[model samples]
Target chain A: MDTLRKTRWLLVMLTLAACKKPTENIKIVIDTDVIKYTALINVTDGQNGSPAPAATTIAITGTAANDIFELSGKKDIKLSSGIVTIGLRPTVAPTTNQPITVTAEINAPGYNRETRQVTFRAETKQQVINIQLTKTGSTAPPVVTPPPPVFNNVSLTFTGRCPNRTDLEIRPSVYVYFKKSDSNAAFQYLGYMDKGNISTNLLEQGGTYDFQIVYGAETYKVSQKIDQTSYNLTLDMPAACNF
Target chain B: MYFRRSIVLLLAILLRCYQVNAQNNNQPPSLLGQKSILLNVGTQGVGAEFAYGVLPNLALRGGLNFIPFKAHNVFKISGFNSTSNLSADFYNVHALADYVPVKTASWFRLVGGFAYFFKAKGDIRVIPSDDYKYGDLVLTEDQIGYVDLNVNWKGLAPYLGVAFANTFPRNKFNVSFDLGTYYLNKPKADITGTGLLEGNSSQTPQFQSNIKDYRWLPIVQINFSYKL
Candidate 1:
């Protein structure tokens, strides 16, 4: 009887040693986009092609105003650094025959209030509307400057990181803007980034630049030196982490 | 169906053994220089082995085994309706030593061995079952894709078990049972996704951690041996 007990104990120990804890690390990651049809409104000073003044505000009006919302799903639309992304409500969408149209009114101190018609069509999911505002008393023609010099192609891959989720990474698809790091110039329109990758010939070598993107009513910025032909940049986008 | 057929064959062999009378005398049979060939089926699948008695109470055996299986919709994720495909393949070659310590009970033997698994892999792919929609827009299959989880445990593994019945047949043939477990190497796991689900590759580390300890492969086999 004693020998049998000892044998049973040994077997139990061996079994326990061979055993492992159950799976606790497999997590289902579900990512879904709510607002599909979007329009990016960029407000600029008509005289010198700079961003609108700090106090500029945007208001949506017209028949489809009720269906319009900020990319963050808020009814109130405000500009951050003279840019705001607006989208139709998740439950509403435009049809092929009956497209949705709304008027975006921009108000800034000392500059003439400007309004632009924004339209959402069934075939287009994303569109950018540029609105230039002139001073109320100025009748002079708007200044037109030559475009920036084009240089060797520079490739950038942006990775969005979540502050709270270490395991989650985001590949954002949106428009990009950039300016020299040391300059106070308003960000110029770069090309659209498709799934976090973009190649452009606008950046000069040995120059440092700040890249920016606006998504979900929030702005994310990253800076990099342009010594190399390719770079991997990381941006903290807490707004895009709503999974 | 194959597993069912193997069980039926094992039962028929057990019945045949019952009909044959047991040896009346209890003197342990001389096993030196004796050899046999065995065919087996169990949790490890079908296999063939050769056994040689090298000592009075000990024998050495060598063999190979393989199993390939595939199924559909066996794995699922909570709150997500998806169709899944699961496949598993395992193949190994092994050598073992069987030692009988009790002269009075030669029918029971302690078995220890090591096996080198040339191929041990499992894969599961899950795809969204329904037509996915983004807001009010319907998406095509290419716009919304699938996720695959893979794991491999291919390496040398040590085995421990016990065998019941004589190593060699009293007559020309005999049937025996073996129960054992193989301590396989730590598994490596990964995840890959295509299209919109491509970001799921970030979850590979967590998936590897979850399956790191799943290294024990259990075996329960019935062996039919014919003496040479």
Candidate 2:
């Protein structure tokens, strides 16, 4: 009995001595947005709301043209799937009297040139620009795609996942698309996702949809059923897309 | 100061009791032999000691003690969404003297000791949970990082307490309780953070200030002894 007691005491002491510090493997993280003013420019065929023709280029012209830049900080902006995000440099701020104004000149090989004015207000940090281009000398009136079927309003919250860094997440600001998971149809534009959140009446309740987003040549996809009115979805992006 | 005054009063009473008992009867068998060993467990940790009777009323002891413990989710900081983990380790080696004055009641004695704690440390880390978000982007674990807070008080400490029961058992077994405190040396603290959290190191001074006055460690322990 005495020896047993002694052994127990020794075991207790050894157990305590082997304890490791809690914070030894812990870490904290923070992310920041340096681009304060952003706008998404989506160009489409006027007839069917389909993607614009290839080799589309966008030009900025105005007093504040020098301050315009792609959301990725590039001065040369191009369209991807009829979409591009442009923003004012972090250093520029628009005021009531000095509201920044710029003109977007979009040109494609088979479509008539189109120009639209883009204005930046101080309070609104994000905006969307939808440009519908008319085909040169086409006689048929523009065709409008039928609206998506709706059951109940649904809100989707998107989170961007980084492939290389498991601990980092991104709230993406990009256009979103959806299609029936079992169908052969191409993905159709749903709406814009602002900072990873969007609410729409397009998702029918009890229907399964495959969601997709194209950024920098990569199209990421996630599938979910619209059983509930809301969903938190994840879109995995490559390491190069981390910003 | 209160502990010192109490110790003086206790010694006086025990000495008076011993003197009276000695005048009425010859000295009984010595309370302990020339050598004895003890195994103890207490609030401070677990330890073993070897004791030698230096006089009929006093004995000298030497021993070592150690404690290791880890606590999870013990800390939370405001304005930061994080999970905190805490751990502590204390180890010491010491020499002490036990003075028994009451001839008839040898179980009660006064103890004073000095210990050198070669390993006394506490650590806390704050890790951001997976739910953490900045704007609309969820951060990866590496980009988010973590912060660590470390404090150490590894040096000499003085201990004082009362030991109840004999230092050496009458037969092969003995049990005793010790109530005392160790005044540890001043503590030095530091903070470090990784990745985006590296900025947390600036709070080290504030943490140090909050813990500057925490230098006293109380001990309540039980010892089992055997005569050698």
Candidate 3:
């Protein structure tokens, strides 16, 4: 009877021993200093340009319809941490882009969370990732407005010959303007010429334009005006615009 | 021989730890600057790789890497492709992990990882429009502006791929090559910025796609790392 008892104890101990490896425990003993990621409610992610709620929890799902990825060593990932990694299996492919997502909650207690959306980004090989996290209680962030279109600070105005096309190329002159205006009758010399011609500025952020076109002996006038409302003249050039 | 190799690896690890700890010792080193430098070279890449162990049924592996690549991107317009090579450089970084649930002398490794890419710079030039008759026509620099845009700007990109490698003879050096592709965002252009350094952003008068994808550039490289 004693022998039987001893054997049972030995078996129980062996089973326990099999479960633990010194190295395996190292990952779980995370440094308390490890910061957990949290964010406030944010605006739409490249969406309608509006504010949204914070995320609740991020669940890293699997690959896309025709994708593959193995999250192996990532098994030790902590849920509480901002970054939770999954494990990949051997033979699982590799990728240059990390496709992972997280879901967010708009509001919560003591924690401020935010909401965002994930869309199809053109990237290379493998899985689609999604991770949604919840936020603690906090006030929502401000709504974002669609940024006005920006123009090239520097314009490319050059004088070159027409290779094959004819009846074009009227004494090479690059038009540089700040805004467009039909005020030929308004202030005379410095009103505003629509951003109709290429090689000039895109007339950005209500500004004054200094028009100067050095063509032949004719000296066109210069004008100055505040861009209240302006539009880009698609001036419609060939697919091969060589200016 | 296997036993001898194990002893060697154990000693190597001990030596490394000893060296690291010894740096804390103010005492002069007995062996001088004879500290060995071990460079682990492997081709497992940024993804997953599997190795089989006859003695041990299972094993684990993880890899993180970043590689820089230089490419000469040719801009094609209308029907003409530029022969005047305009090149760009970009980088990709990611972490790779592998698992071998099954056991054998040569175990199959399931691999997977994430990829991050840096945008590439491209060159764009505008073909101006001066003459307009029937169809879309290109004219002199006077009539239109040549907007040459190069997508060689830098941006982050990611990727994932897996490969299998077999270790030969106990634990000699092993060689395995990997091929994979990740996402690449067309480098954006700042038309406002100028000068020769501009590399032609103001010239790209038009673009067809908003977020163009240049993800087809395949990555092929080899890996070689020694097991401790």
Candidate 4:
């Protein structure tokens, strides 16, 4: 009788063990990166260096105009807060000897019309074009400021963070802009950050600054104090979190 | 198909051993003080064990097992024609107690044990098999890149199951079969990529969720024992 009872217990244990299926719920997710070659077009008020008037419009011309589209893959490109990201269509790309070029024309009701040449080279996937518009007839050539004073080289590695997704991190490949934290001066162009890393001598020790990047018609900003030679900074980039 | 055939063969051998042992109705000798060394192979890989009889109906065994395996194109992603390379490494040390309950069926035993897994990890890298094109440009492999999924389950685990034969050798030599499973520690999973696929890190959350419950490692082994 004891042997029979033990057999039954063994069978029950085996049955329970067999009920667990470990791989049944496993799922694999794959995401794609579409827009590879892009250019950021930034337009600002030439007088105070503020964002262009709310009504400013952008148009693409030249032979390659038809091959260009907004970062969102829309052909009807317009400036949002005076910034827009334009890219070559997924079916179009530049070759080593043949670079793709387009003319971006900016227009505002009270500002002079301006056009900038945007080029997409095979070697460089990202570029930034800055356009400053001056009010009609009040012409002093657009302010050309002297180079920033040389300072200690500071390396900033910017990581883009997704607000809703804590596990995801983004290494942004885009142009950066910076301004002194206490100054009202417009954000000045910082060099392009290649895969989240950039080293520049424009920052001074014991100073605080705000860094910004404009993408998909939105501007994301992060602030840091330049007390160290190397720092890792994070920005809330909702636009880059679509994946 | 090979695994199914192996299980069938093992069951046939177990039945033969039972028939031979049942022909003699005399009570089996006490196992106390008996010792044996065993070599085994099965789902958990090859291993060597040392077994000692500690009580009339119980024996204690300690052993080590390890398996390092690699394969290609074993994993697939739907809608993505990619080639995957998979590798797994598992090494562990375990101590178990085998208990016999009924005198008439001394051949049957229940096993309970604990194992410390020193190394348990699996990695798979998926690379695009075709010529990848970005826009109109054909990209090199370095630019197209690959995604790697890694999971590690390295910790203490508890084991339970049954054996179909006696734990100690009956005479000079004997064979036995063990069927069991180990409940491993929760696994940690992550995904990483290079080049254009670098954005795949965003999928780490989903990968972790999918692999959270993968803690069961089953064993089906045959042991060849020699009395020492």
Candidate that scores best on TM-score: 1
Give me the runs in candidate 4 sitting further than 4 Å from their true place. Answer: A1-36, A71-76, A123-126, A165-167, B1-121, B124-146, B151-164, B167-175, B179-191, B199-228
lDDT of candidate 3 over B1-228, digit per residue (tens):
554684486556545534543453353222211111112222211333333333232232333343232222223334322222333333444544444334331323444455454434434343422242111122223322233444543545444454334322124444443445444444353332122112223223323132233333444444554444
Give one digit per residue, the lDDT tens place, for model 2 in B1-228. 554684586567546544554454453547445678898887667899998988888899999998776666657664455787877788999999998878676767899999999998878888876554332334457766788988898999998988876666556665667778788887787788775566556557766665666677777677878888
DockQ of 2: 0.07
- Write down the worst ten-residue block by lDDT for model 1 chain A: A7-16
- TM-score of model number 3: 0.33
**Greater-DockQ candidate between 2 and 4:** 4
Clashes of 4: 0
Cα lDDT listed for each candidate: 0.79, 0.72, 0.31, 0.77
Docking class of 2: incorrect
- Model 4 has a DockQ score of 0.13
Clashes of each: 0, 20, 118, 0
Cα-lDDT of candidate 3 = 0.31
Where does model 4 sit among the CAPRI classes?
Answer: incorrect
Model 2's interface RMSD: 12.8
* TM-score of the A-chain for all models: 0.78, 0.74, 0.19, 0.78
Fnat per model, in the order shown: 0.15, 0.04, 0.00, 0.04
Q: Candidate 1 residues B149-220, lDDT tens each?
A: 998989999999998788888878889888898888898889888866776787888788867777778777
Candidate 1 lDDT score relative to the true structure? 0.79
* Weakest ten-residue segment in model 3 chain A by summed lDDT: A25-34
Candidate 4 per-residue lDDT, tens place, B169-188, comes to 66778899899988988888
Candidate 2 residue-wise lDDT, A54-133, digit = tens: 78778999989888877645666777778777778766889978788899999998888999999999988878788888
Query: Against the native chain B, what TM-score does each candidate's chain B reach?
Result: 0.89, 0.83, 0.46, 0.96
Return the TM-score for each candidate structure.
Answer: 0.64, 0.50, 0.33, 0.63
